[model samples]
Target: MTHGRSSNILFIMCDQLRHDYLGCYGHPALKTPHIDSLAERGMRFDRAYVQSPVCGPSRMSTYTGRYPRSHGTTWNSFPLRVGEMGMGDHLRPLGVRTALCGKTHMVADRKGMERLGIAPSSPEGRLMAECGFELWDRLDGLHQRASGKQPTHYQARMQARGYRTDNPWEDYANAPLGDHGEALSPWHLSQAHRPARAAERDTETAYSTDRAIEFMEDAGDRPWCLHLSYIKPHWPYVAPAPYHRMYGARDVIPVVRSDMELRDPHPILREFHRNRVSQVFSRPEVRDRVIPVYMGLIKQIDDNIGRLLDYLRKSGQAQRTMIVFTSDHGDYLGDHWLGEKDMFHDCAVRVPLIVMDPSPAADATRGTVSDALVECIDLLPTFIEYYGGTVPTQIIEGKSLIGLLHRSRAKLREVAISEYDYSVRKARVGLEMPVADCRMQMVFDGRFKLVNVVGFRPMLFDLAEDPDELRDLGADPACREVIVRLTRALLDWALRHHCRVTVSDADLQDAIGGEARAGIYLGCWDQGDIDQIIRSGDSGY
Candidate 1:
């Protein structure tokens, strides 16, 4: 079970990639040879969720070993605060050569830096340095409000590098506009859009992979941690050719087939479905064509992953290296008529988590599926525990998967949590454009899910009964007890994480009814007595 001095760690993460899209996860149409190969050589987790469903929050949670609340980052623009610890800080002290390539998405702001679990008051450029990464290729931040169809920054960089300009969107069915609802254009094929000619080159992917391979190959006689992040399979899903045409247009499997059902829905879920239907799943023919391209992106990522693994094995470092493959979050891919990961659906929250040990086991869960219910937060503790590092009990909220890896998954937590705090909450509610005070927390116990919106009714879903989550069981009379039980659990969990407003049992009962509970207050409740708390400064404990 021990490795040599040059034992390395290759951490691969894909943006907005889903577990179901891969062949190893029972996707009948899509071909994920590289992903399947990794599973064959490692262990695949079936029920893995993110601490936060959004890109920035999810990634932040992975690096910090804390949920969004504990880490103090619940949205995209917010940064991890200073003095908060992270995996980078942990690894640096161990003398490991640390490097991050592609997109780290760690913002450089007082708020963002803090939420990233770094020092809050550090100088603008100091967070990255203080993150303890020896090498970094951070991309320039793009203004989300920018008006442009193309990824201008990416395109410009690619053009400068003489990247190919051929069928750019060939395998990028998720590309915005241009190819919207287009026919099965043979132009979506590889020879038509070669990688060498990708007009919009992902410097993150090509350069980061190259950098990772170089570092891994050069790290002789020393241990290292290299994070190779891929940006493809995210938005503007363009990938190089041959990859785009790897599967037939009809071969791409839609993880979320269009379903108009919004049983007991919330406004956010409603808006999400509307956009998904219009943007990606408008027609059956278009749906058929888009999937192949999406799969193409996954295949491209898999190809790069293979390249990294091959290099490690060729250099005789495979047995000494620990490989972990996962995504920041899962993409909707036309499920429930949605295409991204902002919502609380399983398709958005559950991602692919595969861990490969250098010491292969005869009875290891290699190529097998496990529903032990893991999440991104566990990553930090897993590595720390694996390497025998000093992990403070307070900072780490994640449980290590090493036990599961060793087949001793006893006393694991029954639930995983994620949060969101977009400044646009009121906009979502049709009240204002940017309600900066909005916050949401979601608690999932693998079977049932509860989402507590600061200003709305919490959403509850029975995943066992409705795996698609098409039915919202939050207000169902049949699930009333379930809702109350989960609500209590969610409130206690929130209070433990310090993200909730407290209210006393007496005040709550006086405000809502005789049955008010002692737990976290999601937002300003509108009950007469609860309203009195808002007015009397006793907003219920």
Candidate 2:
């Protein structure tokens, strides 16, 4: 395919949003018309999975097109090593400028940047730039902890807008009003029902959306990839005004869980269920109160998406821009008796993936829903292919969805992989295990999902039979064959992805007599070479 203006990419990422929450994904109540419109105009991936089920590692995979193990950013707050290349590094050479407008959850490799002498103020030193993006507005969205003593830019802006308080972000944006009209911080689950004191235009979502629009407007003739990352629907569980009132407990979907899941649950599952956060979510009252606000946040995101799309159409960029909508990872929201994201359950790993390629070639597949196994890492390669750039097969561990978008191929991979390293939270959860034993890896084929945990029994679920994942067949003697098959498949996947840091085996084999063999001293290249070697040896002796 030839490169054109249609190659521009608007990569929209929401935080901790579940795949099934959107209206297009068959949500029974929540009406996400804007997001649904994107799905209707593009390809909706029903089985898309993130590389990791956490924020940082998942976003790292999305930006770098590498697995968490490959990139070495295994969890939130973990830095992506300095040498790892991001989409910007790959796309910039091809004249595609990548920019970021919102949250990246990127923990900079200060040591790497220091060794390389890349100042934080420099283009390559900025958080967004570290991931190969130019920063239009880099807002990490958490005002409470903005790099030690610094306040978040969003908070600063809110203060500038006269929403001043000791901590305006928390007091006005995240906290709800008490009976006496005092700030009720979100730490209390009851605050989930309270509407944010911040005005609609001052919310983090609104700020990100406005900044994204500004960046798109400022982007010149050069093809650009704007990562419009929103930090909403994540935490504090509060929405502004009408969105907060848009839904109540009635609108929330029924939690997909069963008491059977808790009976003799896996050790990790048991620990997670007993965790304070999970315990809170385990309550029906908490779920009823919190889920509505969560839904409200999603509604706000949908509305902002509508605004962004409207801007694109009005500005004539709609026809030429490829719009990608996805989340870093899914939120559990009490599903499976867990809250927040960290588990291998589909609620935490599977995310909404809708790609609207504006090229005329995509018309045939427009509004098509694909059940192909796709990974978040694939976005990098997809953008590369869209812009006529070569996919760095050696570096990127994902396949481009160009074929699927163009209806050239029916499927991409046989199975999707997701990994989580919960070692950092082991101590907090009172687990007295070594960090190495605190991790879990999951592999899901279309019908079956297997979870492999270090120092723990593996979990197997037949999605075909138990879509809710209420049953554990890991210990079932009858399910031994399925377990073995999945274990072997996981092993194969690990073996294939292991030790990819250096030259691949294929490359090494291909270089048998190539430049890799250059300057080598064979037994005797020639009589003259032999004579020179003999003379040199005699002189040394």
Strongest candidate by lDDT: 2
User: After aligning candidate 2 to the native by TM-score, how far in Å is the CA of 165 from where it should be?
Assistant: 4.3
lDDT of each: 0.66, 0.84
Question: Which portions of model 2 miss their true places by more than 4 Å?
Answer: 127-129, 143-153, 165-167, 179-181, 427-431, 497-510, 515-541
Residue by residue across 1-541, what tens digits does model 2's lDDT show?
A: 5459445899999999999999999999999999999988999999999999888999999999988878888988888888888888888888888888888888788887888888978866774345878867777755335445665566677778887654666677777866776778778887677777778888888888998998888897889999999988888788888888788888878888999988898877888888788888888899888888888899999999999999999998888899999999988888898988868888989999999998888899899899999999999999989998778687889999999999889898888898888888743356677866677889898988999988778998999999888898888999888888888998888887544645655676655434213444465657786567555542111
The lDDT of model 1 is 0.66
Question: Once all C-alphas are superposed, what RMSD does model 1 give against the true structure?
Answer: 11.1
Candidate 1 global TM-score: 0.77
Q: Candidate 1: list runs displaced more than 4 Å.
A: 1-5, 110-130, 139-204, 254-264, 274-282, 360-363, 425-437, 497-541
Residue 378, model 1, lDDT: 87
In terms of lDDT, the poorest run of 10 residues in model 2 is 512-521
Residue-wise lDDT of candidate 1 within 1-541, one digit each (tens)?
2344456778888888877888888888776787788788788888888887788788888987878877676777676666566677777666666677666667645555556665634443464533445545543223321244444444444446554443232322223223433323333422222232332234345555776777776666778888877776775444455665576655755445434455535766665556633355545565565566667778777777778878877888877788999999877666776655667787888888888866543146666667887888888887776665755545677887777777767436877777877564333655342465466778888788988777667788888887878777666788788778877888787677333223333344456522234433445545665656555555444
Clashes per prediction? 29, 0
